[model samples]
Every structure is written in structure tokens, then in C-alpha cells.
Target: MDMIVQSLRLGEIEIPEEKLIYMERPVLGFEDYKQFCLIEIDEFKPFLWLQSTEKPAVAFLVVNPKIFVSDYKIEINSKEIAELDIENVNSVETYVVVTLSDKIENMTINLQGPILINTENQRGKQLVLVNSDYEVNYKFMTHTVEEETEVNREVPVEV
Candidate 1:
């Protein structure tokens, strides 16, 4: 089954129907749109576009939080699990929305609200972690500016 989506970046593209993820509840701030497709691009490895099926121009950049935060974890209660029709916990795929900035250094990830998808059922939900250590603006990269350098050259030093 071929599905067509008016992608924000790639104009129109054909995707498989099974590839579309159905959200039991709308993602935060996007209440009207529930169906979305995860589009992968070679240039954006480890990051994919969550394109809304209802709104062609609506899309989000999402990435697996575990990639950067190795200890990242979200505890979903039985209610949420059952809501997504998730039979196996291991089958859940987690992703966090990425916020890009004019300065690459200011790029951040919304760790507090992570999207959990049940691959088995293609159902998903954006969950807000209660009492989580994560932050909404978790910087993708941290840099420290050195007042003085050996060559006296101003370079953004990554910490």
C-alpha cells in the first residue's frame, strides 16, 4: 500500500501505509493532528522527520534520547501502556523532539516530553515524565568559551 505525504522538505513522497504511526492522543501543542510518519533521510542519521499526515507542512525533528543521554529512561504506567495497546515493553520505541536554533550550539532536545511508540500497533503518545531529571531545553552540545588561548584565537571550546 502506497501512501503519499506532502513533506515539508521533500515535497511529495510515497510511504507505506504501515509506516504511519497513529497517536492515541495528540502530541503536545499539536492536538488536531494525530497521524504522523517517520521519514528518514541519509543526511540526518539518528534524526528523522515526524511528518503529520493531516497537515503536510507540519513536521518535527525527533531523535532517540538514549543516543545522547545513555541513562535516559521514561517509566510509563500500565494505563499508558494499555492505551497504546503495547503488549511488550521492549517493543516501545522512544524519541524526543529536537529544537533547532540559528546557532547550532543552541540546539536542544525536549527530554521532559518524550514520544513513545508501540511498533507492534503503530500507536504512539507524547508523554510528560513526572518527576524526571530531564529538561525541555537540554542542549545538544555544550561549549565553554576560553578567555585566553595559546594562539589567541577565539574558538568555541566544546565541553
Candidate 2:
């Protein structure tokens, strides 16, 4: 089924259309949050807020693994893919949960657990990186959320 993209809100944050990062699975504890859009309150940085149309109140702060542990990889099972009806890997969007800090730049992402979604079908899943050496919070220093938003506006983020 072709899932329609809808606007979402989290707390006082408004997740824009330009911030969406599609994935292959509609994550657990979030079966309702299928089609999610990602927003970076700070750009060139590692922290972002996730908002799904299915559950507007549901928003998560996430980061990229590349920012922290340079060599992090997540192993997904075939059964999980089949469950989400995922065919192409490109359709999946991955986001690591983030735990904020007093110093925004010091914020860390949860690499040990990652949220994956199939944008094509609006399916999502939050899987544990049990076999990998990843942390719940991986810290990094980069641009502000506003900066990232500006860049995304200039150039569309693909897949």
C-alpha cells in the first residue's frame, strides 16, 4: 500500500516535511508511528527529533551511528524484513535514539538500539543491536538544528 505522508507534532516541536527519513519497519512500541519525518533542531550535528504522522505525539531524538562509533553495523534478520514486506534495502531509514544533555553538542545517540522504517509501505521497527559494539549514547559535535534544516531545504535528502 502507498502510505501517504502526513504532518506531525511532538511536544512544542513541529516536524516538517523536509525532515523525513523513510525506513523499512514500523518499529515496535510504535506500530502506529509508521511514516515518520525526521527534524534536526541543529544542523551539521548528530542530534535529530523524529515525528510520525500516525502518532503525532510520538517524537524521538535520534542520531547517526557514523558520528560516534565509526564502525557500527546493524544485522537485521530476513524474517523481520519479510514481516514488514520490505524488498529493497534502499527503502529503509535508520535512526538511533538520542539522549539529550545539558550541553547540546555533548548529546549522544543510542547506537545499541536503532529504529528502522520502510518508507515505501510505511512500516517501522525498533531493533536491538545486540551483536554489535554500540552504545546507548554516542556523543558528537557539529552544526545546530537550524543549520541542518537550512541545508535540507536547499537540497532534498534522498532515501
For residues 1-159, write the lDDT of model 1, one tens digit per residue.
Answer: 989899767799898999899999778989999999999999996789999988988899998776666667677777887788877777788888999999988999999988888889899999887797889999966733223222221111111
| lDDT of each candidate versus the true structure | 0.80, 0.59
Q: Can you write out model 2's per-residue Cα lDDT over 1-159, one digit (the tens) per residue?
A: 333434354344444454454444455566655566665654534566667656656777766554454445566777777866778877666667876689878876777677776667666677776776666665654523334333321111122
Clashing pairs in 1: none
User: TM-score of the candidate numbered 1?
Assistant: 0.87
Q: Pick the candidate with the highest TM-score.
A: 1
Error of 1 at 79 (Å): 0.6
Off by over 4 Å in 2: 1-36, 39-47, 52-57, 142-159
